[model samples]
Target: MIHLLMEAKKGRLRHEDEKTSENDTGFATVEESALGKSIGKMELTHDLITAQALVFFLAGFDTASTLLSFLTYELALNPDIQTKLQAEVDEAAKAGVSYEEILKMKYLDQVVSEALRKYPGGFILVRQCVKDYKIEAERDNEKDIIVEKDCLVTIPVSGIHRDPNYFPDPERFDPDRFSDENKEKIVSGSYMPFGSGPRNCIGSRFALLEAKVLIVSLMSRFDIVPVKRTTVPITLAKSVNLTVKDGFWLGFKNRNR
Candidate 1:
């Protein structure tokens, strides 16, 4: 995934270079300007291109790493859920499951949703203050919080997801918590695995679907058993964006051929 992002960045850079060169040549010839003037303009263009590429490259890498960590931890912890998911995949394969068929797997979807809720890949959701505003307190006992322009606000996603008030026994791995009926009870903005609003992760659906397909395909053919080395209490990697501390190590055996 990181490699893909790098390759994309390189491709973007190459395209930008081509465009810049063409523009510089065209402008210089049209205006009969000196080569030095064209070179100066090109240098500025190069800086802008470098900045854009760096931003996108970092963004892609961060997003990909977060997603991989989230999925990895869920699979490691939930063996029973994994088994059921494998069963679904086996059945689907025999019956020729399409993309549309995968979308209808309510249980699978619920599992993924619950995993994301419990271990939101990104711990913090940051927003910049656009205007001075007074944020009202929801609780009568608490005072209203004041906000100034250009201030950074962080929404603690991890705390919200694990809040006992919103989810009873939040530590338990229960997909049913996100069931159609129970879902209505979940507070808005409290369950944002992919951050909420217009600027939320745009590729969330694609990433999730890809993960499900990959897991389904692998599980259909193998029985993934926890080895002695597999950590019982998973730890989050402090350095990374996702919940991967020590890598998940499991033993896989062919499922009855």
Candidate 2:
């Protein structure tokens, strides 16, 4: 994959140079092919070529799949929410939800956002200081601290998401928090399911889009209900990992006929 990308990059550069040389003429005889056009946009910089391919192979699927699993679990646990979501999906179906329509779905976005908040795929993010930073003592017991350049810092995403200060009744799986009326009240920099600022997950949009498509399709055709073995208030068991004493047990009941 890297080799192909590198070769494509080289071809793209060569093509661009050719175009530049032919600028004197009103018309340049460019190759009439689709691959050439595609190659023109392919990027294979030393920093990104290998990493891009590897991230595509791994990062995209795992996080989105994890989110989907928990979304199913959440809906199963809250039958009322599940029914409400299905009703919303039913309306979208009546109106013919296209790609644009799916994204604009208000309730769908709320449910997905709430799921991400409840079960962040990556619980934390790490960053390094580019320069020296000073922390003034905020409490009497603490002293001023200096963090020099390149010092690593950890940000706890789950802690922030679950904090009652930011989210009232943080334990409740309520999608209304992300609704149009209530979402504006969310404290800035409080929700970090995909980290924050510039270095956050690059594939967040892709992940959300994939999640929405799967959920919309599933809810439109079936119901996510708790089975006999399903556990409620899914115990994190004093562990942050998405696990219960009894594993997530959900039932998918077909709504058709």
Top candidate by TM-score:
2
lDDT of 1 by residue, 1-257 (tens): 34444554455322222233321211001122233233321333455657665765576566645654555556657778777777777777776867766766666677767777777766688999889999898997999888999999999988998999998998888888877698878776678777766556545655566656666666777777768887877776776465556776777778884
For residues 178-244, what per-residue lDDT tens digits would candidate 2 score against the true structure? 8868888988788878776556665676677788889999998888887888776666654545445
Model 2 regions more than 4 Å off? 1-50, 237-246
Where does candidate 1 stray beyond 4 Å?
1-73, 137-142
TM-score, cand. 2 vs. native: 0.78
Instruction: Compute the lDDT for candidate 2.
Output: 0.76
> Whole-model lDDT, candidate 1?
0.66
Cα RMSD to the true fold for all candidates? 12.2, 10.5
